[model samples]
Target: MKKSNEASCHNRVSQQGIKVQLEIIKTEARGWGVRSLNSIPSGSFICAYAGELLEEKEAERRTSNDEYLFDIGNKYSDGSLWGGLSNVMPDAPSSSCGVVEDGGFTIDAVEYGNVGRFVNHSCSPNLYAQNVLYDHEDKRMPHIMLFAAENIPPLQELTYHYNYVIDQVYDSSSNIKKKSCFCGSSECTGRLY
Candidate 1:
């Protein structure tokens, strides 16, 4: 598009049904890219941020103020829960929708190995996370939804800003403003300045 930092974006696709897979490819200026496995339509819930559940207090305690939403208890190449979501819930995948604690909420873990974790960071991302209603009338599990921020094409790796939009929510916990632009998105501020 505008051509700012275009390295971080890639293609992704679902191999068979809802199980979308991530692949590494290349962009025009960006080298070594991973894109979508198929042509994903807009407004589609690409996949859940599946992982282990933990209480907010525990997550905060575990993360030691890392500022990451999900407490992965371990780090993956994809950047999943390295710790836990401090303000979220703590429990197993309960009915896909249940409170992990009073006033505390549960978060998806990459323990189940969801592809969404590897989506990576982008100042301008194609996908965005949406907290949709977790319906369990049919015994369905509650889950956070990932929607296309824009129309994603086939072979494009689905991506979202990993900073969690702390700036958008006015969250002062992020070090992004101080971090460098490895995402190389079109909107890469060059530096956090």
Candidate 2:
């Protein structure tokens, strides 16, 4: 493998002949989204969710009423995943160890992030987040790599499910702040969370 920095290039051609380049563009519905600039094959790495890493507690406190935080807690264990707008719950466990300690953390991309932050949500998305442990063996803070879940054509918007959990609390009127989905896919659930 190439150096960690080189391997994380946002625009480069890999040995597999897949062009890994992405661009951020305004979307008709989702405001802004990430689009491919070249054909990408299934399972090819797209880009890492680069951002400021924060401690679990600090992350929770910061994102309690925010939206740019991505939960990476479950990456430490082998069980079901949680965090983000997905399966996260009030009772989820917390960790204090840093990325090098194999402990949980969150990636806050509100002020500092890469193009990966622009990828929108889709009910039937063509991209997926894969926890990649490159340059470090710690699984808890693995690089959140966006990979093509299927063959992606050039100029196509890359998206993935935000995996927002919909439950009783979500149906309550108090949570009217939930955003709606405009992905336009037949499978569109109509809501972002």
TM-score of each: 0.52, 0.70
Off by over 4 Å in 1: 1-34, 64-68, 71-103, 106-112, 136-142, 163-179, 190-193
Count of residue pairs whose backbone atoms collide, per candidate: 45, 0
- Give the alpha carbon lDDT tens digit for every residue of 1-193 in model 1: 5653333322222211254455755554434445677776665557666565666555544433332344222211222321122112234232334323233433434344455555565677777664433244321223545666566788876666554333332224433334344677778765322
Clashing pairs in model 2, backbone N/Cα/C closer than 3 A: none
Give all candidate RMSDs, comma-separated. Answer: 13.8, 8.2
Residue-by-residue lDDT tens digits, candidate 2, 31-147: 888888898787676777778998776775674445577776654443334232132124545443233444478899999988888888888888777565646776667677776
- The residue-level lDDT of candidate 2 at 1 comes to 55
Cα displacement (angstroms), candidate 2, residue 5, comes to: 16
TM-score of 2: 0.70
